[model samples]
Target: MRIERLRATPVAVPYVHDEIWAFGRRRGQVSVLLEVETDEGVTGLGEAAAYPSADIVLAVLRSVEPLVLGEDPFAIERLMRRIELIGTWHHVKATSPAIAAVEMACWDIVGKVCGQPLVNLLGGRFRERVECFFYVARSDPAEVAREARRASESGFSTCYLKVGSDEPNTDIERVEALRDGAGPSARLRIDANEAWAPGTAVRMIRELARFDLELVEQPVSGRNLDELGYVRSRVEVPLLANEASWTRHEQLAVLKAGAADVLSVDNQMDGGLLNLKRSAGMCEAAGLPVVKHSLGELGVALAAAVHAIAATPNFTYANQAYGALLSDDITEGFGGGVAGYTDGHVDVPAEPGLGVTLDPDRVARYAELYRTEGAAFSFGDPDPVLRSPALPKF
Candidate 1:
């Protein structure tokens, strides 16, 4: 079927906790939902990771709409090549997310057309359900402890805590509280978000090693693989590369350099599901485990991740699904509304396509919010300084 129409709607969904990370505090989550309708009456849905700004993402999506309007939906490879050509010709990174959204929609259409779930199209299911880790955002130590306790009680086996703040001592305290409150059984992972230098990361990982952390993620800048290797060699805890390995080329570079013990992959950063799968295959070949990364995504993206993780064989670590962090979601119709973890695992929906449906009314409501209130921050803007002591430059 020929692609007929492409519609993109920007939505601003409130975060449940107003999470604070190394970069800044996020009061709300923003994304642009893309709907691709074919002439044969089949429609597909996807989400663009707009993050700090939805306007830019919308503009990019609109710019690429003409290239995809009359093409066949099933020609994903050819379409992606054209999208990449346009992106490279324009010298714009924003086009990546826009292309990813459209590519995902095409995959959704393919899955629905075949009467199979997205996972089935990706080489069948490897597991019945995908396990997700509880994400503890930056907060007071006491508050972190409380949330850790709640996560344990709620059947979560692992909790990922945000660290790498200005005060190293306070970050240590938060980890201690989380360790104590989460008990001995629950695993804890820390993400520095590239807020520390190699030396600082080494020192901090040495101090935090007493708590038995499952992994430490992106302690150093994404640009320095040598520094990452330095930190990884000194620390006992496994160091995971997040921002450093956004693309397949980066993934290979990190793997070749032996910079990290594990790699984190995400659909948004890798461009699309097929690209993520390819990255996972590379990691699998290198005998490294792949963990899924979350960018405080809504249901549309979360569903896509769930499907990808379910089909991926090397995805052993507890994946992050921040859908529970949202106050409301637009994908409520197909069981994508509120994020729920059952005994620390999220069930993969067996329904056709991406297994999530969008509610037009809710989309309209959030779209109105996007137009009126705009965004709280822009990805292009400088990261908000949360404390006084600046992070050490590499």
Candidate 2:
């Protein structure tokens, strides 16, 4: 069936706690919900993490809709290629993310049409549940200890700490406090978000090795593969690559160079499920582990990630897949389908397709709020016209 219309809605979601990371700090999630309608009366949903504002997301969606308006939704590859060609002129992430929103929605339609979940449409499940780790929000040592204590008491098997944000000494103190609070049972993972120089990363990794971290992600800038490789060779802590490995080629390059032991593959940044499988295949070929990355994604992407990690044979480690821990979701019921985790391991969903459903009432509620917030711009303006409210509904 041909795509009938595309609509982008902006929504504001509050965070459970103050979110402070190497990227920045925030109190709420600013996101854009992408809705696509087709001639067959089928509709699908997806979301893009547009921190700072949803205007950028709306603009990107409006600009790209015309490129695929009358095209067949089933020809996803062709649609993606055409969108990419149009996207080359603008900011790559800004353009690519909106396209991803549409791509995911189309896949949702495909799954619905075939009477299956998105994962089943792509491939079959490899596991039942994927283990998760919470990204601790504390910056100070005492607060880190408190948060880690709460997480341990909450039944989480692992926790992720934001390192490289403060002085090395300060980071060391925070890790020490967390380790003490979490005890030896809970795994500890650290992410620097490429906050440090190569020298500092090496130094911090060597020093933090005493705390027994599971891995350290993007300790140095992703631009210099050589430096990343050098740090990997020099440090004992396994390097986990996020921004450094975005595609299958980059993942292969990182593996070939021995730059990382683990990969942080987020579906939004790594294209979609098929590309995620390809990247995981590269990791499997090189005998590396694949871990899911968090992008303030709602339940849709979370379920998609769970299915992907379950479908990949090489993904043997736990990751920050605990979206349930960070988000105050506006859709669905309490606790999306988690297969269960034991000793830092999780299984995949046994249900058909992505094994999840969107709560329409919640979608409508959030959609209404989105329109109210985005109505500041006139429909006649070029910006608002691109994101037409007059788009067809399923």
Model 1: per-residue Cα lDDT over 1-394, one tens digit each? 9999998888887767767777567767788889999999999998987843577677777778878899999999888877777645234432356677898999899999999999998988999899988877647999899888878887889998888776799899999999998999889999998999888899999999999999999999889899999998898999999988877778999999999999988777667899899999999999999998866677788788889899999999899877446678888643232346688787887888998888878888988987887556333224444334365532
lDDT of each: 0.82, 0.70
The model with the greatest lDDT is 1
Q: List the residue pairs that clash in candidate 1.
A: none
Over 218-282, each residue of candidate 2 has an lDDT whose tens digit, in order, gives 88877778979989989988989987886666777788778888987766765566677777777
Model 2 ranges with Cα > 4 A deviation? 51-53, 86-95, 322-327, 334-355, 360-394
lDDT of 2 at 10: 65
**Per-prediction TM-score:** 0.94, 0.85
What is the number of backbone collisions in each predicted candidate, taken in the order shown? 0, 9
